[model samples]
Target: MSLAIKPGKADLHWLLGAMLLAMALHFSHFPLWTSALIVLFMAWRLLLQWRQWAMPRLWLLLPITLLGVAGIYLQYRTLFGRDASVALLALMLSLKLMESSTRRDYVILIFAGYFLTVTAFLFDQSLWVGGYLLLPVFGLTACLVGISYPHGVLSNRLRSRLSLTLLLQAAPLMLMLFLLFPRIPGPLWGVPQDAYRAMSGLNDHMQPGDISELSLSGAVAFRVQFQGEIPAQRQLYWRGPVLWQFDGRGWHMAGNDHAVEKLEGLGEAVSYTMTLEPHNRRWLLMLDVPHILPAGTFLTSERQVLAPMPVRTRMRYNGSSHTQYHLAAGLGSRELARALQLPPGGNPRSRALAMAWQRELQTPERIINAALTMFRSQGFFYTLTPPQLGDDAIDDFLFSSKRGFCEHYASSFAYLMRAAGIPARIVTGYQGGETNPVGQYLIVRQSDAHAWVEVWLASRGWVRLDPTAAVAPSRVDSGINTALTDNTLLPILARQDHAWLRKLYLNWDAVNNGWNQWVLGYNQQRQLELLSRITGTTANWQQLMLWLTGSLLLMALLLCALLFRRKRMPIDPAQALYLRYLAKLSRRGIQAGAGEGPLSIQQRAGKLLPQHEAEIARITRLYLALRYGPHAEPHAEPHAERKTMAELRSLIERLDC
Candidate 1:
């Protein structure tokens, strides 16, 4: 028996390769165990392909699939949500790979690969992510083309060139669709409550240590684009949830029982656009008091803008915030009472000290000054590491250990103010941001997380207070990283001093900023802004759809025309002379038939024209030698056949006409 075999039906191999690549890329985003299962399945498929193992029986596959589904349900605690659905899709792809033995099975794998690509986008569309994903996407596309054209050897160079060309050709249309497509208010199908609940940002309540943990991360929380002048770093206080009630150790938002009746009156409003990253948090970050929000946002009684749904994707909202706003036109007694509530028993020494100070200083400003003076003059240190305290955490921090982060100072300050009969709340959100010189836009990261206090004045509206600033003045003026220089949690990349590397990173960030603003962050407001700038009109859904469809059709037609254009054949001198001789023979009543070979036609023509028989035979012999003989290279005998055909044509022309 012969060990060597001809290349028979390589479509199966191409399909298997595509499926493997798809499975790898798809499961990369899933959990470790899920990815492990996919890897094992791929190995099994490889073993089967190499003839070392066989595919699982139908009975075995059914039970395994059921167990896989059960494992997913156990892990996620449900059969729904984005993560679970993605896992199920990955499992199905793996199972399909195991059973993929035919050409049609391979086609199904290719389509699955495309669907997986879209699913990855649903997770994240960052420029680097989108760019990195192109490898698998192109690989799968090439595998598809290879499977479809299985007769020829798979050409890596040709496939790469063709795949890149196709992607480039499709990019403009994809961008057009992404831009012109109308966005609808979400939950078109109601989203699961736990779709994306793990991301950290401002929660419903501001706790003492909440912002501290947030301050350690380097992830971008949101980005702001100023309409006019950007606000100063010290003045850039992005107000989020305001916590009124304090429980000695932590802070909590006012309960619904003490809900405010109405929004405050707006004064001078600062108009700007904020593109918020997805935090799985509904609260939209803006300047102090936002008077106007983009179409889909709503204003709460606390003067905070909120999205109707949790932001699982990057969102852009245009907001006009009032630097001076009168909150709660008529202050409700219940609301005031909730703001004044504190834990009944904890921090007794701190409470007694606060009461003694309040008796000495009657005014709120005098009390605030005393608190600030205490924080500044007590040899207090601003440090990330603070010693653990007992039940009286506030008393221990204020009197014993004078080292703590912003949350510690903010919490103690709020406790003292409430003890002094001044209604104060802990305001939590990012404070100062690093201004990117390249883009001239504020880049607020998780490290910018900050907390301060807002005390209600008798005549003046809420006034901002920063007890942390009293201890570390640099934190208020500069970014948090500079203030926390001694902290180990700061990003190592920021500490590097390579000028070229820094510049490259910043330039790359500028590109990402542009991509986020124009692509990922493009929402209803951005769409309207773009369409208005282009067409000078508010484009409706129908009009936008028509424009998008028409543009896609035009692009498709252009691509088809370019791909199917006729290829012109290169003309050689020998072929030109041979055609000339044939023309001479045609005038003499002798013409070649379509199916006749050159030798037979030459013999027949020689017989018809006896005087030119020798010349005809010479030309025919040279043409046949070049056409049928071994080692007859076209460029080797340049113009030799042309000279012979020219002489034969002259002889035939003279003999005939």
Candidate 2:
């Protein structure tokens, strides 16, 4: 068998590590059965190595491959989508370990590991994930190098060093390609409908207890880095879905028939850049009324910024918003009716209280204040775990329970406003964020998920109101940690006062934001900017390509010079004199025969040149001793090597004279 098929034990170890890491990346995505099969195949391959057992025959392997394919089909009901295809690829690669017959098979496994590393990007593009992916790539390439090594027993450290050197040499070309490549706006082919999963965040619909469920998650929703002065704590409402129509039990987006007006751009615009985490939803959570819409997204008539498709990866966008804005200068009759519409029979007591307030106050603004006052004075408390509500959820929350998160407060407040014949609705979005000093940016977590009410008045147009704010003012200024009675539910970053943890969190976020900006956010626009800066001109795609080609050429020449460069050998005075003495003997008609020993050569030289016999014999002994004596190894006493070399030099000099 060729060296290709006769795998080295070291190469097998390297391949095992690479395969295990690649499989680990897909841990959460794979089913238990699929993971088990891949692991079992790996273990069987290890056993073959350990016990010197022969690999299974092709007949047995072929049926096992078929079974694996059938199993995937049964598990996912298809073999073509992202999830199914990745799982199948992993299984085949792991099985290849057992079928290893030659060096070519090992090469295939190494490359397959690289391909698997790329698949990880389809799920998560965060900095940590990108860094983690480098390990498997490095390991697989090292294995590829180790298998081809002509020497025996290569150390993992040597293999790793060589692989790192290869990657470093290739990095410039890779960087050039990345910088010059044209980025298309969307995928060219169709994607699987279930390729990505929806995450926890505000949706178009919300029930009484919906927002509280999000509070349990500490995962990041988005990050904001302000260009100028950061917006005030109260003004940092990252608005998302606007729900106008309220069913008796829940709130949802407005119907198509309602011609409701959206908030208009008004005062000074605050410019900021936002890096949003993927929620597999179209809505881009912007501050209350976007002043300038991002390039790819469009503003809905109801004032929500939406992308053309679901964001299945990290998205960075530039936005400007005016905190002071006129929301709906005038409301259409149909929109007013929908906002005020409510189920007639349920929550009678809550509706009656709203009616009494409307009768006494005679203005929508005053009625809003009255409801807020009641929320503050009526023993209302904020809690993540609220009591379950029955048929009359609003009445139970307002009169009996009075303990709930923002959703309950916002939901009941909007219901009361409608009951009093006011145009009211609920706005679901993130409320506050923790500031990171290292990055000087704001991090909004899922725990910051909040719901508030907006009511339309005759004079002020539509006004923003938060009944939750009335009960827990700390929620708006200091964030959810202070607002909650049980701060244990808060995320570590939010509650930890330790200096080390705080520093670590901020530093990590800073690095992550930098990666997101330079890597994942690298698009055609950024490419153009980079090219223009490098060429010192207004560079186009053509110029970018030209520069990229030139850079690659330069890198190629440097690599060639390093690879073929010759090393200079140090001069040895003793060896030079010995060569001269041999030349003298050749001139005097005496020479050493092919395969003749050094002692034989010396004896012949002594017979031919009688005048230099003593010097020749002494020189011969010194030469033999220096080259093949007790001090032959360099580690023998340094002083003895110096002494032998000196004596050989003196004997050769006297003979020449």
Q: Best candidate per TM-score, number? A: 2
What are the per-residue Cα lDDT tens digits for candidate 1 across 1-657? 121222223444555565556556556567788888887887787777678466688998998899889988998888788778878888878887777665566667778877776666665567977776676678677766655554565676776677678788878777777888787755232246555665668787765466777777878888887888887778788988777767667887764454543445555567887878888777888887667777877666566667788777777777887666666545567666766788888888888988988899889889999999999898999876677877888988988988888999999999998888888888888897766779877778877888898887777657778998999988888767667658567654333345787678778878998998876666676687777777878766676778778888888899889889998888655556577778878888888899788889888987887877877887777656555553256455647655655665565455442
Could you tell me every candidate's TM-score relative to the true structure? 0.86, 0.88
Query: Judged by lDDT against the true structure, how good is candidate 2?
Result: 0.83
- For candidate 2, the clash count comes to 5
User: Candidate 2 regions off by >4 Å?
Assistant: 1-5, 151-157, 187-191, 255-266, 496-499, 569-654
Q: Please, what are the lDDT tens digits per residue for candidate 2 over residues 1-657?
A: 255557678889889988899789897899998899888999999899999999999999999999999999999899988788889999989888888857888887888889888888776667899899989988898988888877665788998999999998878778877877677765322247556654566788999778888887888899998998678898989889989777788988874454435666666788999888878788999998787888978776567789989876778889988889887788887777877888768898998898998889988778888999999998999998889998999999999999999999999999989998888888899997988888789989898899988888877787889889999999898788888888786667767556798788789889988998898788778889887887788878788778778877888899889988997876466556667778777887877677777689788887877788888888878877776787777679979888988878766766762
Q: In angstroms, what RMSD does candidate 1 have relative to the true structure? A: 4.7
Clashes by residue pair, model 1: none
Question: Candidate 1 has what TM-score?
Answer: 0.86
**Candidate 1 — which residues are off by over 4 angstroms?**
1-28, 47-67, 150-154, 161-169, 184-194, 255-269, 322-332, 493-502, 528-536, 556-560, 563-566, 570-577, 584-600, 614-657
Error in Å for residue 99 of model 2: 1.3
TM-score of 2: 0.88
